[model samples]
Target: MEGGGGGGQELSTDNVKGIVLALLSSGFIGASFIIKKKGLRRAAVASGIRAGVGGYSYLLEPLWWVGMITMIVGEVANFVAYAFAPAVLVTPLGALSIIVSAGTFYPE
Candidate 1:
């Protein structure tokens, strides 16, 4: 669920395309997160420095920095994926972001 920057009843053609793109983008993003989480865990084990969370924030931890960088990289990767793949294939794949984000935020 991206591009919720505004409220509206109807989306313009461009908006429709953007929503489609964003959905596709999210899938790539979700996969990136999984890869990042594994890498973060490995690094923490190797370096003996674990990430911590507190005070409504994740704090200044290595995993936090890695997550931030992964977000940026994932956005870039999604653009690349869209460039190569058709929107139909990409949209559903990209939607993994919504499910992943929802699970993280509203865990079972």
Candidate 2:
């Protein structure tokens, strides 16, 4: 059976870039999870802010603001990193953040 194309097989750089962006986004999401968790912990201890654990806005609690900002910045960096590097490589490197977060955040 003939495929649908001049021949039917040509790699698109855009597809690769999209995949890279997706992976990069994933790493940022993981990092965001850690950061937001830590931030919520902070906010809870802060003395003047309230926190709840239901719904979408729960992730944006005042204690979690620092985390939100950090995650935003990290995501921007991840995109830039992915634009220049392969997802396979970038994702592994981003995994390091998990260790870092566990050590720093989980302890508190």
Which model scores highest in lDDT? 2
| Per-residue lDDT of candidate 2, residues 25-98 (tens digit) | 55555667776886766655554454664334445466466667767876776777666656665666666556
TM-score of each: 0.41, 0.48
What C-alpha lDDT does candidate 2 achieve relative to the native structure? 0.62
Give the distance in Å from residue 83's predicted Cα in candidate 1 to where it truly belongs: 1.3
User: Which residues of candidate 2, in runs, are more than 4 Å off?
Assistant: 1-35, 45-63, 105-108
15-66 per-residue lDDT for model 1 (tens digits): 5555566665685566557645655565565656655421223333465566
Model 1 global lDDT (CA atoms, 0 to 1): 0.59
Residue 6: error of model 1 in Å? 44
Native-to-model Cα distance after best TM-score fit, residue 76 in candidate 1, in Å: 1.4
lDDT of 1 at 19: 57
Clash count per candidate: 2, 0
**Cα RMSD for predicted model 1:** 11.6
In order, the Cα lDDT scores of the candidates are: 0.59, 0.62
Clashing pairs in 2: none
